[model samples]
Target: MSDGVKVIAVNRKARHDYAVDETYECGIELLGTEVKSFRDGKISFPDSWAEVINGEVWLRSLRIAENPFSSIFNHDPDRRKKLLLHRDEIKRIARKVDEKGYTLIPLSFYFKKGRVKVELGLCKGKKAYDKRADIRERDIQREVSREFRAKLH
Candidate 1:
């Protein structure tokens, strides 16, 4: 939410299904049409994920819809895009992901300083009970806020 950062898309399902432990800001490689589609917020990443492959991170399942204005050079909507990250950082993330129950997923996509950036989250899968607990907690908080508002008025 800093200056010059414009969020394009967020994967809400990812946050609900997994517990995010850490996040990394990474640059994404994109074609011209893909960038245009992002500017218009025509992207979906419900089931997208990131993986460290051969010492590099690749994002899979991110769909950038075609721009109607673009001609025959449009990029594939489901192309696997490469992520740009420091070598040491990639190694560190790869190490953590190799552990049990840990995985990498894309949290959000945004434009930073006129360039596209991706937010990658290091996450662990949550259990059914855990999700239920989160929902219950949220409801309790909402009730508390409502009661406080009514008391003030």
Candidate 2:
């Protein structure tokens, strides 16, 4: 089977604010109208995250705008969604999250093989100095690329 991946939304701030140590791709429980909203690219996840609750993982703060055609049947825009993960995987994630400074964050959302999938990141919050250093490194990389291009021409 061909693996077709179509990205729906990405939380760009998550990477800048947290240092991701590992990532997991899992399916999310979504409503029909929510899926339609995704197809329309009407999704926004601000300050969104995931947490292991009662042996299950749930995504919180994800906002999928209601589909115009769904009227009364449209899903709630701010409802938390369940993330489908294996029992063993959830247990492992819970253990890791219990460690100090580690937390779960949603990195991106996409459609894989016609089904919605979530990319969850196991991350540690970055300090202010860390963010500054990242910006410095990015600037240096940009300059280096510019100089390399100039030399080639």
Clashes of 2: 0
TM-score of 1: 0.95
lDDT of 1: 0.93
Which portions of model 2 show Cα errors greater than 4 Å? 1-3
TM-score of each: 0.95, 0.95
Q: For residues 3-65, could you state the per-residue lDDT of candidate 2 as single tens digits?
A: 598888888999999999999999999999999998999988869899999999999988899
Candidate lDDT scores, in order, read: 0.93, 0.92
Worst 10 residues of 2 by lDDT: 1-10
TM-score of 2: 0.95
- Give per-residue CA lDDT, model 1, range 48-130, as digits (tens): 89899999999998899999988898889998999999999999999999866588999999999999999999999999999
Model 1: lowest-lDDT 10 consecutive positions: 94-103
